[model samples]
Target: MPRRPFSPARNVKTREASQALPPLPLQDASAAIAQSKYFLPGEDLDGLRRRLARTLAAVEAQPQRWEEAFYHALHYAFPGGRIMANAGAESFKANVSTINCTVSRTLDDSMAGIMEAAREAALTLKAGCGIGYDFTTLRPQGAHVAGAGATTSGPLPFMDVFDAICRTVSSAGGRRGAQMGCLEISHPDIESFVTAKREAGRLRAFNLSVLVTDAFVQAVLDDTDWPLVFPAFRHEIGAVPTIWRRWPARDALHTVNERGETCCRVYRTLRARALWDLIMRSTYAYSDPGFILIDACNRMNPLWFSEDIRATNPCGEQPLPPHGACLLGSVNLAAFVRKPFTAQAHFDFEHYAKVVRVFARLLDNVCEISGLPLPEQRAEIARKRRHGMGYFGLGSSLTMLGHVYGDTPSLAFTTAVTQTLALENWRAALAIAREKGPAPALREDIELTPRHLAQNPALARDGHKAGERLPARLLHARYAPHLQAIATLDAALIDDLAQVGARYTHATSIAPTGTMAASVGNNASNGIEPSFAHSYVRNMIVPGEKAKRAVRMESYELLAYRALVDANVDAERLPRAFAAAGEIAPQAHIAVQAAAQAWIDSSISKTINVPSDIGFDAFKDLYLHAVAQGLKGCTTFRFNPEVHQGVLVREADLAATTYEFQLADGSRVQLPGDALVEYEGGRYSAANLYDALKEGFYGKL
Candidate 1:
């Protein structure tokens, strides 16, 4: 009888049977990303999901409200990269932050002040947060520093110090740190700042931007002389010729007016068009130093009564004041499509709203656990309770619904989805405030000023006088331009909000979402961008490693179409509805962004892709058009292979380009960028390997 086969008791809870089996192997690309980027020791894919959902929900003021069903929503609503990676893992570590974006306290002009700012930035970066700084406050080169009795080296050299600091922190922390360096358009060092990235290996850790003012735009359009100015030095204040201009910093050397302009001494003057051309040419070639409409940002700011925004986060999505902080999350729009690629296809907005509402609460909870490094940073969050709840996968979702990106139908669809998301976010904010007291800033009494009246003329039309005192809730809901637009959709909701303030100062900002979209979103198109290509190679930086590895990637739309419609799909030959970033017209991209911007309070991070062959006239015209279209800011990308390796590379571009590699033995080898080479048991694309070595990050990894 073969020893009776050692049969176990029937229905018995045996240890082997009772114990949970290891989670099923990762189901798809998204799982693979989660395992590598997010998972901790002894954690599998499901373990990560459970851990994230459990940990985040436990911090909620009303945990029981979302403890059960919130887990399901996590599948569709993705927290930002920092939030997902750090929210639940605090138990295993110290000095980590859940917030994704922060801005340093206004940098002082003294050397001690500069070093203090750098120290705060280091602590912030070490905690896995991206920070921004306004450098225009510093005196320009050749300016007298009374304390040191020497001419300053100017803001550009200080920026280099910050860049190096970012690099060092990124290397030691095992998480790449990001920084944004902003200089006002009127700064004497603007020219140098505009072309800073042209030099290889300079400012490697920063995303540079010029804070373009409305006055500067007017001067450029008029082709008139533009003054380069800085705050008058204390000793020479009366001797210097001064002009009144809007400035971010204030001190005894400067005096503010009812209109918010400060007195500054002119250092130099140049033809505005010449400066504009320089900006356009440098950006066209280097793909950076994006321009932020500083005037527009301040005018549209919800906290205009209290804050003056001079800089934005690395990607230019969140324009922030000194010491400001914000957490970020996104709802996966592609996950809401029903009956994709069919005549009856439609977005399941009902379910989408549910996820957005839950996500808003989860983000609100993050404020409680925000482990910001500095006391001011933490205080900023506690006061304003600002968070950016955005969405990703607009491009992939549009394709899935049979709409072409940047087309008429696509613009309409984008508008509808964004409007719905914005409204729901506000509603969630209001509901949360009703449960939990409103943000501290909202409860305070704020004074109305001439700037407020100028920003919102409707207030004067309504007989509201400047210098009047009003509750911040009323100022935000009834006076803020963004909320006034929200009132058009739901007057009662806005009224309720006025009676009881919202949970956060800002509700929506679309980030680039590069890594988040690629990994957790299963290669979804980035925020507000069409697919780079149906199939491409992405050079991704590995945390804790020096080198970047090129990974082959496919668009989410292509994967869905292949799985749902055609099993044998050729990526190169797709339907008319399929369009990549390179194929779309510049106007179309701006139109799509404008449609979304109408509802978004915070800025949108979008790059209007232009062909390298596009003429300078056409390239320059895009910025003017963006300004005319009422966009808060605009950024464009044109490939320049000589400048730097792109984050995303199309196979066709790679195959067409050639790379020459110089070995340590003084021998050289030439290969197409797409060619693969195996070395030390590891494989890498020729272009990526060359770039890694040239950039001095290859040998270690």
Candidate 2:
């Protein structure tokens, strides 16, 4: 296959169509943040856009024309912060990755393997990549370590080691190092992992999640007993009562089941509902340890035959296998609405599809310059060529069109948008594959086995026989379940994909673009979420600062409505369509996520916000509802001032809350959280200052 020549003739119409709707003007804070964070020395936002455009356009034959098109695309859809900061930044002498997410290689249950994993993680973080690791492979606490002739301290201690490493290593480009730590539902130490974060200041650098299985969910529903287990070693196989299950490791000694599960020995059994209550209680109190549907993620994985995913990146969006990596970008949905907030307001699907197509190619080019730190990580990305290109500002866009978030019309609109994005991205994939070849994973030879047929009976229904060798692309295009969603939309496209394949294995994942939205998106709703509040203060992590600085911000739609509809509109008195996160029903959020998940190849990073006073049983049921809705994961936040403060805080919530600030002499000064306090020639909000002192970052400033 030969690389395609760059041609901007087709995109001319797209450019002209979008010209009628120019990019939203950046706000004051947005401009300053963009300049200080993303802009290179002596460069403004426009110059930075041009630099990225030129760098990404290098993949095309006519770099100059494609560069211009890419520059225009940046106004509507931009890459993640790391990409914006590192792309074409070699001249600045920074050795950092443009990729955003990566997972550590499968860790072995030994000291040597654990140390090696830590070393690799340190390097990966230093190179500016957020990494995830599953800690279930290690033996349970009190388990004998024959090599050391003593009991092991278990995975929690190992997590502390990694947490220290993360705190010590300053990620490239001055970003705080990020990490994800996951444990299996059946791990013996699951209870400890669930409650670890509640101990304040422990594992602060990591986002924790539980890898939940379908069997576990069913057990909870059926009120059955759940066994906590670990893999049985060859020496202990006959000594212990063993059960067959699907495990992350592929060791030779483990006995395999018909469906490819491994033999494991049960350490103990607990009432399923009891454990569920424990998880739900902790999540309700502290909002830590989100849970991922492990089985669903693997079942829908495009490369199901090659990889097993046990963890996700820091945000729980991109669930990756060991050593896997992915870059991220999102289209600005707010930019596509024409005549916003008017009777004639509508999203331009035609223009939106064009941007998706162009963005598909742009993100693919990023793989060539990923600059991943570890060889295994680079090799994994090269084999799969995965990237997550989703959209931001869904809530804002829906509101702009006079539709409330999570209503029937809103769900319908979300489905249409997501379906269009999926279809167009696949169309671009086929074109790119024909031009520059499919991902290596797609071209590899794979043998269809009973395990494959068991995992997906569609393979057998499509006439794929067991023990037959076939191209991986055929398996993916013709038999993969996710692609079938669009089979009716364009049957010919699906047929063509069977023969032509795609440039990347996975294409779409929504991300929680907190900073990206605030800076570049003019404070649009964070990915697939309703506005947190109309007016709020965001605590931003400034480099070299002791504590996060508070910046007041407004939702993009609110700003647009005031400017385009009514300049004097009161923030408190809004139209019927304006629904904030706290105002929307929990079920509504699940409905919207379920609608979008149908078309998204990868998972979504969405948080359902519930009122702090919501009942305990109702909060616990949200997870069950999310699982029933077929979401890959579920995360929710109920603000607890005593536990922790979030990045986004509503003014009213702060005003209603109080913080007690104690001086060095033992006298305590109590003030409302929103009150400004002067300390050492600096002004800080009482809440922000309290958090800084409690979290131990105030001294650093």
Q: What are the Cα lDDT values of the candidates?
A: 0.83, 0.86
Residue 160, candidate 2: C-alpha displacement in angstroms: 0.7
Q: After superposition, which runs of candidate 1 have C-alpha atoms over 4 Å from their true positions?
A: 1-32, 255-260, 543-546, 664-667, 678-682
Q: Which one wins on lDDT?
A: 2
Please give, for residues 1-701, the per-residue lDDT of candidate 1 as tens digits: 01111112321222222121121223255565666667787786456567767877797666766766667888787888887788789677678998889998898988999999999998999999999999989989998877677899999999989988888888777677899999989999999999988887788789989999999999989999999999875666678888988777787766666676887899999999999999999999998788999989988888877788989988889999999999888888888887666655688888898888888888888898898989999999999999887888999888777777888999999999999888999999999999988889999998777877877788889888877988999989987788889999999999999999988989999999987888777888888889888888888765544456777788887887666556576887676667788888999999999999999998999999898799999999999999998899999988777777888887787888889977779999899988988765668888887777666666543
lDDT of 2 by residue, 1-701 (tens): 12122122321222222223445578877776777567889887788889999999997988988898898888789898889988999888466899999999888888999999999999999988999999988888987786688989989999999998898885334677889999999998999999998886789889999999999999999999999998877787889878887788776655777777788988899999999999999999999889999999999987887678988999988999999999999999988888675555789999899999998888999998998989898899999999899989899988878788888999999999999988998999999999999998998889988888888887778788889998888878876667877787998998988898889988888999877887888888888898898788888776665576788888898788666555676777677677789889999999999999999888999888899899999999999999999999999999988888898898888899999977989998899988988887667888888887776657453
Query: Each model's TM-score, in the order given?
Result: 0.93, 0.95
Q: Where is model 2 more than 4 Å wrong at Cα?
A: 1-24, 171-173, 251-259
- Which pairs clash (backbone N, Cα, C closer than 3 Å) in model 2? none
Instruction: Output the worst ten-in-a-row residue range by lDDT, candidate 2.
Output: 2-11
Cα error, candidate 1, residue 313 (Å): 0.9
Which residue pairs overlap in candidate 1's backbone? none
Q: What lDDT is obtained when candidate 1 is compared to the true structure? A: 0.83
